[model samples]
Target: MIDTKKIRKFFPAIKAGRIITNNAASTQVPVQLLELLKKLVVQYDNVHRGQSHSSILTTEEFESSYDTIAQFIGAPSRKNIILYRNATEAINAVMYSLMTEFKDGDNIVTTFMEHNSNYVPWYGLCKEILPKFGINVEYKIVKFDTETGALDLDHLKSLVDQRTKIVCCSGASNFLGTINPLKEIKAIADSSGYLQPNGDKRSYLLIDGSQLVPNTYVDVGELDIDFLVWSFHKMLAPFGVGALYAKEELLLKMRPFLYGGDMIAEGMVSPEKVAYNSLPWKFTAGTPNILGTILSSQAIRLLMDFSLNPGKQKYFMTDKKLERKDVKKAMDNIEVHEKILIGEALKILGDISSLNIYGPKTAANRTALVAFTCKNKSPFEIAEKLSNLGIESRAGCHCATLAHRYYELNPPASCRLSFYIYNDIEDVRKACLAVKKCI
Candidate 1:
């Protein structure tokens, strides 16, 4: 078991007696990261646009931040990582960058289990924007088993044909709390011999890892995914930073999502010809979030240190390069801890007769969240009552509208209790007991 007492001390929210069980949306920032933020302010300056010593220092930190993030996900290098506002924006960036690649006969395949951020952008691409231009692209959604919350692999396989351009899926369902079989999905995508602009003959796979990456180890290289997106805020950093990881070749061939300012190569822009900057920077336009970038990277470092040696500061506020084994060990520990917490939550909440839980019944098959609804109580009312009892919970589709609707929930919402590294068994008990009281 993880040292919850030691872990709780790092987060002021836990100390303040707030039972923070809504971690799927965003995690509370640790005091270490807060302190790092303060340190960054004194040395703050815009990166790649100044000559001051502070600018140079901040620039190095910001750039190295990419390396830290890339290494955490087992990406090849910083070239594969692009920062965005959130996972939603990161996925949209992929849509925008690859917008021109769609053809008249092409289609995209997603699923009913996706968060709206993953589904709506494709919906707009195929149904709205592409149709307006007279491009006859289609978007197909695969279904999951209503009872099991498992993806219909056969249905997913049937949706991909030679004309399928891209396959979008969530790494884990935020609402259903199911961990998808990505390698199986990747195999299905690979079998679809869809030709691409880059001469590739398979559908590109994009995993919306907003939920997966924060709770488990996600090696982009090992998974062999063409693209992956997630947010730092979900992993204990403050808001305003997210990440997109794509293959180096894809980033090289795709169009830049945004254009202006520093994305252009130094002294390479003119009326006659314009050139873009190298690799990751081409995707980052204008003034980037330098301070947030630094803090987010340090957040990963701090998480590693916290997992490996709780309450100690080995990796945070240091310049050490993260080792691959350490990343695996830290993430594995986190995954196990979360499994235990979620298992206990499922048990406690399952005991309530009127409460209908969504997603995989086994914690081994799901992420660290439990989303459910009580038959006689509206989800919003239950969530409000839980709040009154000083317990935190989320009520809504939790942005997984498609999944919520798939379950045929009236008003289409659920009450969710999610746990993180700092959350202990006691917190889960209180949240579950409060849920019982609310019902």
Candidate 2:
């Protein structure tokens, strides 16, 4: 199956005797991506602003990076891709762009299991921002099953109605580790007969794919999502680049999230009026993270290569357009590998007396992460002890405050261990055994 030995060589972190299991926050960059970053720095320049050869070359790579990201996710084209600082900012962009569109009586539906990035934006929009403007748009949160950590689709259906303008949900929970059924969620969102300015008869679906995109293959066209957001750091790339993929039609009609130079068409501005640039650039305002964007795109290529040919460099540096089948094959292999790792983690950690695991018990129902709480043991203390044992773990709300409150956790915390491509069965065993030692 997966060559863990070969894959571990690409990441220098594993060689340094570091057990990097806290991957849900951010993954370590491979040596390949680090080299790519080094190569990009010499010729770096601001995109769309300079006429030098370096500018043109860097712009070419930067723009092509969008194509790579879009192709990886099965988006139609680069026109549908928009770059942001992170997934949170991308979701906020949607909220601001559609702020004026929400009527007084309309409501937004989201799940209780969502990361704060998804929930807090809508909460601020409906409760804080819109209220000051005299708009009373309501935000309704659907509950989940506490035992299984699964979204209650019936409750979601009950929450969505004709007045629901948007439905936002996470593709996977960072704390609970549950992979939500997006297609079924889309079906429910589509049934909401909310009239929009674009003449659409259903609510728009926005998926927070920060966790799901890194672990599984996501096809936006097939899923019929209006918007999708994810961060590159969670994958193999470094920080400072996240992606937003929306339908071209939606990007064309919706207002620009940020406005500045290069967003306007050349020479189309006058004292009287100004015209905006075309599809993707209109959304990209000021200077972007050129080096980070290139590395992020190359990270996708490297991930594909790693999945297909573990130790080889078949697709990493190539400029070839990524094929859909190759993406599916690579993601499927990663999914299977992660499932085995998480399954072992669940088995080993579940053996500990009084340790309660969150999310689905089966590996198939969740991503490659395990969060748990124990009786009479503080999660923070457990995490600290695991750290002393050289086992990396996260202990906090994990940006899932609502879900922690839902479970009635006293300190609003749980210990989590998440895996990536470089992690193997041994890594899971050590992390779990460390947890056992802590308890």
lDDT of each: 0.93, 0.93
**Deviation in Å, model 1, residue 130 alpha carbon:** 1.1
* Tens-place lDDT digits, model 2, residues 280-350: 99988888888989999999998998899988988888888888899999999999999999999999988
Query: Model 2 segments beyond 4 Å from truth?
Result: none
Candidate 1 lDDT by residue in tens digits, 146-176: 8889999999999999999999999999999
Q: What is the lDDT of residue 195 in candidate 2?
A: 95
Q: Look at candidate 1 and give me any clashing residue pairs.
A: none
Clashing pairs in 2: none
Task: Tally clashing residue pairs in candidate 1.
Answer: 0
Worst 10 residues of 2 by lDDT: 1-10
